[model samples]
Target: MKRVYNFNAGPAALPKQVLHRAQEELLDFQDTGMSVMELSHRSKEYEKVHQKAATLLQELLQIPNDYEILFMQGGASLQFSAIPLNFLPSDKTANYSLSGSWSEKALKEAQKIGSTHTSSTAKETGYSTIPSQLTLSTDAAYLHITSNNTIFGTQWWEFPSTPSYIPLIADMSSDILSRTINVEDFSLIYAGAQKNLGPSGVTVVIIKKELLEQCPSNIPTMLNYQTHAKNKSLYNTPPTFSIYMLSLVLDWVAEQGGIEAMERINKEKAELLYETIDQSEGFYIGHAEKDARSHMNVTFNLPSEELTSNFLIQAKEEGFVGLGGHRMVGGCRASIYNAVPLESCQALADFMKSFQAKNR
Candidate 1:
């Protein structure tokens, strides 16, 4: 079978070894004579899988003792409403920074739950860069920011130093485990497991114990973070297969030297691709500003939409897939998550150079 270097945004590339291991255990997981998918979520065999996944995540991110990691169903989109539901009360408001489509979706969900304020927004700039100045509310429930804008190819290189008392919440769906982060910097962090961790269906929520305490009882039991925390993510039939696959992915990450080593490789990959775009001399134009470019997702455009369309077609034929940009943004986007091999980036860069030479 010819395996193409996959570059889709989510349900993206996973470690080849993880896929192999999953296939090996698909028939019977650990002598149970049943696939993990067929096993009872409450069984001791599944319990061990859950525990090991959480423990490996803690070790990978160096999560402090005060944080509770809950693996729950529903993608990060669910957390958009869940965040405001659990954290933002009827009387108080939450602040949102509008950077891209996902952040806009998050803000819309917050508005449905309660009052929300746009602390800062880059909509006027066509979502090409991160807002320089953030106007935050002193008494807001939390300051929400999308750490990386996957669609627009913008990333917050460094988080704004907000007031210590004002808790920070981040939607890290795109670039969650790709780099080392000070886990204590945010009051809450949530990401879909599909991007950097594992497959789809499971969303990881890392919440400070204090923030969990703020969750009110009025909300649905499933939406409440504390409920998941207390139940150890067994509140319902958990996404057992997703969690098992995540365990293998996290193990692969540790084998590759953890997040620090990932950061080095990510930087090198982004630099190579961005440099190719910059030096193209009008043949290729990057959409995001240089300082604000995301190391995870790179968005760019060719001289014309016709050429851009042709480029994507040719790219796929060359074993490079998922190079089309989102509908909202009419261009090309290459998502280089942690699992994307650096050699793949080199291949893409070399292709870009040859494509430009022929087209220009």
Candidate 2:
């Protein structure tokens, strides 16, 4: 079987091993005689899959016992509304740092719910940079930030320091599990499963149990963190197939030596592509600044629109996929997530060099 070098931003590539394992169990999952997709969420078999995914994630991230892992739906976008609904009070203001498109979306959601403050923003720089100075509020309900901005190709190398009295919430949809993180540092973290966890239809939410206590009593049952936490993320039917795949992916991550290994390989892959861009002598112009470059999504532009269009066409013809940038930000973006092999990045680097040589 052949595979293309995939670089889509989301709903991206997953480990081949995980896909194989899922294939093997598709018809008969541990002699249950039914596809995992057809299994009841309450069944012992499904529970094992559910708990295993959570446990592996906890172990991999070294999450404190105080944190509860809940598999919620609606991606990180939904959490934009859910976070302010659950935590933001009429009296206290919610603070957000505007890093990129995702962060701006989250800020918009918070604004609808209550008073919000922008601690800092890179909007003035066209989201091409991560703000170095964050103006945090001590009395705010929570300080929100997006750990990685997929569109702008920027990531936070250093998180803002907030007092324990104020909650720090992060939308880590694009970069979770790609590197090691101090889970205890944030009061809450949410990531949609499509990027690094599994597939779509599931969003992993890890929150300090103490934060659940602050969940207002009047919010919708499903939106309350306490509801999912109490039922262990099985409050509703849940996304069985995605969780199963997530467990398999976690297993693959563990087999490859956990976060440290993922981080090392990810750095190598990003460096290979970034080095190609840096050495191109103005043939390529990177979107994000050097200090805030994302290891997952590398965004750049060619010397002209015609060259960029030709590059995308040739890239696709050469079995490279998703090299086109987002419409909001015109250019090219190569999303090299955790599951993307180093060989693929190297191949892309070679292709980029060749494309430049001919076009130049």
Runs with alpha carbons beyond 4 Å of true place in candidate 1? none
Model 2 TM-score on a 0 to 1 scale = 0.99
Candidate 1 whole-model C-alpha lDDT, 0 to 1: 0.92
Query: How would you encode candidate 1's per-residue C-alpha lDDT over 1-360 as one tens digit per residue?
Result: 888977888889998999999999999899999999999999999999999999999999999999999998889999999999998988888999998999999999999989889999989988889987888876688899999999999999888766776789999999988888999999899999888989999999999998888899989999999899999999889999999999999999999999999999999999999999999998889999988999999999999989999999999999998889988787899999999999999999999999999999
Which regions of candidate 2 deviate over 4 angstroms? none
lDDT of each: 0.92, 0.93
* Error of model 1, residue 95, in angstroms: 0.4
Pairs of residues clashing in candidate 1: none
lDDT of 2 by residue, 160-210 (tens): 878888989999999999988899899999999999998998999999999
Per lDDT, the best of the predicted structures is: 2
TM-score of each: 0.98, 0.99
Residue 317's lDDT within candidate 2 is: 98
